[model samples]
Target: MLEEAEFDRDDAAPIDMLESYFAAHGWSHERDDDEIVAKVKGSWAEYELRAIWREDDNVLQFLAFPDVRVADERRATIYETMGLVNEQLWIGHFELWSTSGILLYRHAAMIDGEGGGTLTLDQAEMLIESAIDECERFYPVFQFVLWGGKTPKEAIAASLIETQGEA
Candidate 1:
């Protein structure tokens, strides 16, 4: 499990460690108070992912909002598809903001107490990489459903179908 790893906090905020990790990878990010926001470019879209450190709650919240907006007419279908997608996801889950009709992926990593748990660089990288990869892989499926008028099952099936060059 992603959250099962023991991180050595060393009495520092997890958010600070996250900032350093991003810097080490040459990814430019902005830190605002307790939150860090970074823009990531993917194959299909540019994503803005935010990591917020909730010190009092001992949790690090990560959120990614794709550039696509769920059309009002397609909201129902998208919601249904998201439910199915969430079931297959191991770490984070996709959710729709009802008011804005925006789809977002969210995952929270628990930091045990003030000095019990630590967020290692590897674990942090895993969390970010998994989220970005999943979004990149499924983004096309979302477009198929919203614009191509395909059913949820059909969309998923089409997305999972991989093509290979002649070998």
Candidate 2:
């Protein structure tokens, strides 16, 4: 679990940059040295966005966990759905945390520069925005499988139905 960061805003830490981004977006967030967690409201549900920065490896991993929970019985179905869902995604992939069976979207980016791996505000915004977009787009498909008892293919199909126009 990441704790609230205690440092001057001028600090050059990547997590601090993210803290400023969250603040600008009016999202609640907490940050430690290596990780920062933010709560963002999406169209379907709230999301817990966790970003871990590794200065040594010059990498950043971003994860978005929707409020949806996969039940023990639904794990098999969700797992199958996970594979199919990942097939359609271009940015990141979805997975179920083995221990908790929690569904989450994950993406990792390699940051390389001569001086160091510096995280820019624009990069942070893009990473988080994409994650939130993917989650909102897919949350209903997970719901379709979980409660609607729809097959993986069926759930994906239902989610793709394009409404013609305004009702």
Candidate 3:
């Protein structure tokens, strides 16, 4: 028989920290067990973001699903595009949920002090912000491949902006 993990009441749990973090940012969110669900509006589209706390691993994983869904026929191309996009990202990577054909941007942060250390609000905010920024940055490229019928290489090439100089 496995025993349930015990957490200190005096200190806020990881989920609680995440909830408070989102609220501070003025974002509406829901907390269910170990998962925090929130909607973030980006330049490209609104995303459904979920943050899951894994006690055993001491890792908080964030996943954001874009409003667009890839058709079965386009999965291969989209997946290829994702491969190229993932390389340019500093924090998270985009992936396709094969079973549902949904594209998701994912990133995880290791919550330090797992034994007794608390996860600071600053750390939580950083994790969420990084994921959102990465998703918004590459969202258009994904759309170009899925709906615009652009090849993976072409879509990626077009998304790269060549800054000329200060005008």
Candidate 4:
């Protein structure tokens, strides 16, 4: 829940900043963050999934997932899967900004907002991998939307960009 940021004009690209920051904290992206952000913004292909994790005061603890796609029945399927009808959970996208792991986006949702929960490394990895696997399972529908026919790994990298404006 980070408020307005007073960003420095000389701030490095988010990916670089995040990597250095995470490395300092003993964390690292599975792949390069710069390339991922570029691909997502450029939209070379449809990223199939996206996710983010935040801690107290809106600082992001973790962020990952495949990019999003907007094709055919797949779009509907994704929304349906994520709807969580009776559950209170919602999907959130995180944009990188600081070396301290703070998020820049404001529109992030609270999945199961009524009952907040903790996220562990295992949970984060599971959620991200599951989303990628689900998208792969529904390849026919997802392929036509955003992935631009690239492999799942590429899509995952693209997802790291963390678009703030797009829903």
Candidate 5:
């Protein structure tokens, strides 16, 4: 459950901390009044990280995604892949934004107050790392579907084959 009382932007927005976090990581980012967008490079892909402060809802919404574009023709298969991928262990989930044709990982944390928990710098890092890690782990499945023309089932099956020791 979450409280619905409106909060002042200054009091509720954690944009400053978020900015500081991005700076500490040395990632290029831009911040507006209530949102920060950062560019992150991971092992498997480059990602766009977006965090929005919702004062009224006391929620911090975070989204991170690789630069893959989902075409309209493949949207249904991608959605099916999203469902299969989401069924595995998860903190956040993948979504393909229909209008934008972008696939992203999204998670939200309740920031301080009644019914809202706290968000420390460490927790924020964990939250972000979780998203990126999931993206890295599953990037191949998405690719298999979009580029390799594999069905949702086949894509996930191919990704799950744990290879032997590295070459």
Candidate 6:
């Protein structure tokens, strides 16, 4: 059985690290009120990378898709199947960060049955990249990036995100 973990919003925001990561990689960060949003678009329409940092720990990231938008569609089904009525599952990489600048967890939109647990920074990086590599099976062209602590939403989202392309 999975052990229940405590989630504190004041100690786990991954956006701080993300901002540093992007800047180190030559991406710029644009502040938008409480959210910091950024986009990198290449010649190919599908080569765009969009990301947003909201509050202390909510980071949403997404890669543009040339084909059907799989995240939105899959998320709708998952929400309906699980009977979630209060939240909207938008397409892309949706992540919620806690306050400590650590990636409490993350997941993609649409692909349900995500799996996650507390992880070190290195572990989080590896898992996130692995999740992206597996996206082809579920959404021909989809990539989601997320950052967040273990809130209920984050937990559920993480599970669904991990299950996206599993056999």
Query: Pairing residues by index, what is the TM-score of model 4?
Result: 0.27
Candidates 2 and 5, the one with greater lDDT:
2
Best by TM-score: 2
- Which candidate number would show the highest lDDT if scored against the true structure? 2
What ranking emerges by lDDT with the best candidate at the front? 2, 5, 1, 3, 4, 6
User: What is the RMSD of candidate 6?
Assistant: 15.0
Q: What order do you get sorting by TM-score, best first?
A: 2, 1, 3, 5, 6, 4
Alpha-carbon shift of residue 77 in model 2 (angstroms): 0.9
Residue 29 lDDT in candidate 4: 38
Query: Could you tell me how far off, in angstroms, the CA of residue 141 lies in candidate 5 after the best superposition?
Result: 0.7
Q: Candidate 4: where is the Cα deviation over 4 Å?
A: 1-50, 56-118, 143-167
How do the residues 1-167 of candidate 1 rate in per-residue lDDT, one tens digit apiece? Answer: 22323334423466776776666556779998789988888899988888998877888899888877887888989988998788788999999888888888899999777564456666677778888888887888788899888999899999978789975
- In terms of TM-score, how similar is model 6 to the real structure? 0.30
Better of 2 and 4 by TM-score: 2
Q: Candidate 1 or 6, higher lDDT?
A: 1
- lDDT digits (tens) for residues 82-129 of candidate 2: 898899888889999878878999999877655466676556767888
lDDT of 3 by residue, 1-167 (tens): 11112222323667887676666566789999889998878888888889888887888888888877888998888878988998898887889888988888888777676455356655665677778787777887887787787888888777777779897
lDDT score for residue 151 of model 5: 95
- Greater lDDT among 2 and 6 belongs to 2
The lDDT of each candidate is: 0.80, 0.83, 0.77, 0.33, 0.81, 0.33
TM-score-best of 1 and 4: 1
Per residue, candidate 5 scores C-alpha lDDT tens digits across 1-167 of 11122222213236766676677678999999889999999887889989998988888899987888998988999999999999995588999887899999999887876634345655566777788888888999999999998999999999889899989
- Lowest-lDDT window of 10 residues in candidate 3? 1-10
